[model samples]
Target chain A: MSLSGLNSLYREVILDHSEHPHHKKNLKQATSKVTLKNPTCGDVINLELNLVDGKIADIGFTGEGCTISQSSASMMTDVVLGKTTEDGLEMAQIFSEMVMGQKRSAADLKKLGDAAILSSVMQFPARIKCATLCWWALRKSLGENVDD
Target chain B: MDSKFLKIRNDFPILNQKINNERLVYLDNAATSQKPQAVIDEIVRYYQNDNANTHRSVHTLGERATEEYEAARGKVQRFINAKESREIIFTQGTTDSLNLVASTYGEENISAGDEIVVSYMEHHSNLIPWQQLALRKHAILKYIELTNDGRLDMDDAQKKITDKTKVVAIAHVSNVLGVTNDIKKMAQIAHIHNAVMVIDGAQAVPNQPVDVQALDADFYAFSGHKMLGPMGIGVLYGKNNLLNKMSPYQYGGEMINFVEKYQSTWADIPWKFEAGTQNVAGAIGLGKAIDYLTEIGMQNIANYEQKLVEYALPKLLNIPEITVYGPHSPKLHNGVISFNLKGLHPHDLATALDMDGVAVRAGHHCAQPLMKYLNVVATARASFYIYNTVDDVDQLIYAIQDAKEFFKV
Candidate 1:
């Protein structure tokens, strides 16, 4: 066959983020620290957020998983860094919807930042759980149920 | 063996198809084996000729269904060398069969402070039911550790199974490690301790010849889908004496012989456990599958798989940056191998292999405790069967090399 589909899923940017993840250090003091794991695939994400004055001043994650899951966690931290807690939650919801084959407006898609590139991930049904694990961690740290 | 075992691959039409423009090298046999045309045809014939609820109706189709269903039970009994056909109880799959034993036999034998012994390598189906059973009955759950070579530690097993151990459940073969357990020795130990020995034979019955009476196991459970049969049909082979003493797992119409206002009598040893309407078509297909396996000869199938593992294991180990789990040779590990490439994750490696039309299982293989024991999160596994050839292993090696180059590892 062709490497086209595999290459699309494992984009260069995604690989770079997976290789050199941003804000992947442990936080000593944080507003909330939530650890979530994809029991199906064993992908784990320990997400810590500095929710200062209702805004996500800093966000970091530490875990081991596939490139898609790790890069998704990296990009999630990048997009939700300076956003409000509510906006971060909304961005996670939008990213989840986009990966689930939802058609989001460009304006709404912009809210997800680098996570929008995972739109091709919808074709790989098995990897969808990997892509959304970090987002589930984000929702959990914000006092929401992790399971959908 | 002759080329007949190889020619049997042609009987499975799905094996002739292509994936991603390449010939599909289906290697995930431990997860589920491909069904031959005979089994598929039997399922269709059941739907077309005999489609009726069994055991309750007097119609012609119902009689045919009941006959076919019981015939399938007899097939399973003969397949495993069980003394009585009534020892075979049909259920959903291996998981359901295991749960039946745990809920019924476990509830009757195990009391508070009693111990249930299982190994570290059990799949969740075999592990969780006992774990839940222990939790409910306030019993203790003990583990039989693995040896340094990844085989079951028989000395530890001897130590763990004591008078307090009311049940000893273990896998006949490791789904992840592919190492065969010493079930005969384990059963002897359980007998010395007066505990029932339950063998999770899901991975074993498909690849090797299993004689339950020879093994002296009290209960042997396996799934039909893993052995070229249709899904949703599984067999639970229990000793007649123990089955008579145990209670029924479910309360339903068919499993009852006589029902009063508040009391009920179970149908029989096997039927008492098989509650509700059973999967008649699945049972018929499983019987056909057993016929196919019998025609191939289980000894020949075992030898073919042994040759495949002998050819593949050394080649797999020769590859740099590849770490294979379980025993190094075919002497113990059999046809399954779990390994990890140096830099690539198993999920990504599996996807890359899929691009080459190679199907493999890339996860914990439903043994998270074993995953933790192996000190890795997950690994890619490619299991072989009678239909798989050495060429499939070469394809797997090439896929691993391609992944290493692609990921720049």
Candidate 2:
């Protein structure tokens, strides 16, 4: 397989984030926490989000799963941190659409960085859920509509 | 064996397919075997011509379907050497079969303080039902330990089967370890303890010819798909007396003998356990599968698979990082070889092999306790069957080598 577009999916940046995820601890002082799991493959992620002024001030996750699931959560935290709640939700929608093989115009996916690697994952249908677990957890914490 | 049997490879259409542009090398027979054209054709014929509910109506289709269903039961009875056709009951599979016994027979007979003895190498199908049965009955569940080499410690098993033991359920062969248990001896032990011996023959019956009466087993369960038949058809064989004594698992049509406003009576031994309208096409397909196995001769299939296992074992062991679980000698193990490549996750290895046209099973093998005992998160298993040749083993070896080089693991 060509490494050009897919490299970012397993990039060292993502691997590093997965190996040592940031904010991967239980936050007793956090405003919202949600546990999300991909039941089909047993990939679980526990996300604790600190929401202040309707913005994600901090986010952390801890769980055991494949590299894709772990890295997806790490990348999610990087993209969502410092973004307004509305922007976070909007970004998740675009990411979800991208993973589902929907043709999202480049403008719809702004500054997603390595998150674009997941777009290639659309060709391989099985890994789509792994790429979307973190986003689903975030949407759940934000009280946004999320299925499973 | 039928030396005149048409090229067996031709019967399995999937075997001709190419994966990553290479011919598919299927070595996941223990998980589920590839179906032959005969079995598939029979299933299709059933749906196309003889699809109807069994034992219900006076219609010709219903009578033909019922005959096919009962004929499949007879095949199971003869295959396992059960004393009578009444001893055989069709189930969903081995899992459902075990659950049937645990739910109906266990619920009826077992009481609090009773003990159930099982082995550590059991599949989850064999393990979880007893665990649930123990919980429901307030009984104790005990496991017989394995030796360092994964063989059942018969001494430990003997010690575990005590006077209070009501059930001794064990697997005929470990799906993960591939170690064949001395089920006959175990049945004798159960008899000594006055406990009902239930054998999970999911792994064994597919490979070996079984005689339940010779083994003196009280209950035996196996699935059809693993034996190259259609899915949704499984056999649960129990002694007629025991089956008659037990309650029906599900209350539904076809299993009833009579019904009144305030009273109801269940049908005879096997039908009582088969409450609902069973999988008609699946049973017919399974009957055809049994005929296929018999025509090829079980002894020949077993011998051929044993040779393949023998050829594969040493070649697999020669790999530096490869760690093969189960018996070192093929004689001690079934046709399965569960192994792990050092530093390569099973899923990654399996995916890599998929690219090379080598299909393997990469997971817990539905035996978590065995996985825990193996001290690994998961394993990649390559299981062989009669259709598999030395070339398939070579392909698996080549694929593992490629994976090692590709992943540098």
Candidate 3:
């Protein structure tokens, strides 16, 4: 692989999302909260979910991480906002499988919306955890047993 | 410039490989050094011939293995200028050696309200053991501050190590910053307070000459893999009186003198600490690594690495986007250089550099407290070794420049 291969991992969309992340804040009224750390690299994510009637009414995150993690978190929060807890959990699972290079139908991946762009993360095994860290935080906050 | 050190790279076969269609420039020596063929051959030669349980069976192979293992101990003793081979104990790595000291010596010595002082720049292997020991004993764990340039604050060390201080543990060299601490003076301070000084030489032993007696360190720990030997083998050097007094780190067959149902007597100092069957092949491999380093000479290695740093550091600092941690002057810095780009995280920088086949370490480097102290989550570190050449340093700079262009930062 040449340096040009980095283009697949750090596309313009990913760079834009990382540079100007959405929902990068703390929610004043968080129903459930979880903080996860990628211990190997010291990357941390504090995810706040304001769940109203089993739906993610609002979602926010605050932490320090690399570009992939930050952009992945941005994309994750964009897709999961206003999503039902069940749908959010399923989406997290799909995202995990997607980054791990597992097969997903177009219809199943379409549910991820813009977050599907992260399917390329499979090529960079080292950064797979960085991409999934925020999703793990989302799963744990939505009452899933994420043993991260 | 074709230097003799550049010629030394031929001894390491791994350095000849290519990554990402570019020459592999290994700058992760702080994490682990690549083994030379001599050490590799020594390990293979041992497994082929002297594969037997040491200090047991009276067979020829067992005796040969035992002699080789003990001879490795003698090499380690001379390598660090230890007074006796009995003071050296084989361990898994620097972490295991440190844990041994904490579990045995710290368990016996530390009590409530005593002070255990360490520096802010210590790696986790050196820090957590002492921190947990203090926690277990209800002792106060104090941190000696670093200067603005990232050097260990000697005044703060002097102030922190009072009469109540029972143990003073510090790294002989910072893995991230590459600044050598004043171990001799620090040991003097600890001795004045009647505290035992433990030196973590994991990074130091591989980079420069270390004399435990001259530094007056009561206990010193270092890993073999970081010094070009195999993993799962390390050395813990301690004073004879201290080793005799400390309890056995573990209980098992080799460390036993005689066992009777429930009661058991322990073996001598070194063997008492080395519980089960040891890493005999790894020990012999480390002996070979010591021999290789001895041939080149530690002072010569140190001097050559210093020249590389002097050449590389100014060029690295010239990049406006880079923020280097540690002393800015080449005279004060060693080979380990940690830095971060202006708009790029270290992880991103490391990945970008890897694309150019320059392997650097990017993380907290197991020095999370130091990272926190530096107010950054992580940083990219490029460390040098004997086989590293000036061309490798140029590749590192070019990669950084390429990363900057690729990221448009």
lDDT by residue for model 1 (A1-148), tens: 4555588899899999999999999987899988888888888889999888888888899999999999999998999998887898898889989999998899999888888898889989989999998999998887777674
The alpha-carbon lDDT assigned to residue B309 of candidate 1 equals: 87
Give the fraction of true interface contacts kept by model 3: 0.78
What is the CAPRI rating of model 2's predicted complex? incorrect
TM-score of each: 0.97, 0.90, 0.99
- What residue runs in model 2 are displaced by over 4 Å at the alpha carbon? A1-62, A84-89, A140-148, B1-6
Candidate 1 wrong stretches, greater than 4 Å: A143-148
Better of 1 and 2 by TM-score: 1
Candidate 2 chain B worst ten-residue window by lDDT: B1-10
- Residues B30-119 of candidate 1 have per-residue lDDT tens digits of 999999888899999999999999998999999999999999999999999999998888989999989999888887878999999999
lDDT of 3 by residue, B112-225 (tens): 999999999999999999999998899999999999999999988989999999999999999999899999999999999999999999999998999999999999999999
Cα lDDT of model 2 by residue, A1-148, tens digit? 2112334345566657656776667777788878887644445788898889988888888875665677777778887887788888888889999989888888777656667666766765756777889889988888886777
- Candidate 3 structure quality by residue, lDDT tens digits, A34-142: 9999999999999999999989999999999999999999999999999999999999989999999999999999999889999998998998999999999998998
Clashing pairs in 1: none
Per-residue lDDT over B265-304 for candidate 2, one digit per residue giving the tens place of the 0 to 100 score: 9998878878777888888899999999998888888887
DockQ of each: 0.67, 0.20, 0.70
Report model 1's interface C-alpha RMSD after superposition on the true interface residues. 1.5
Q: What class would a CAPRI assessor give candidate 1's docking? A: medium
Query: How far out, in Å, is residue B225 in model 2?
Result: 0.7
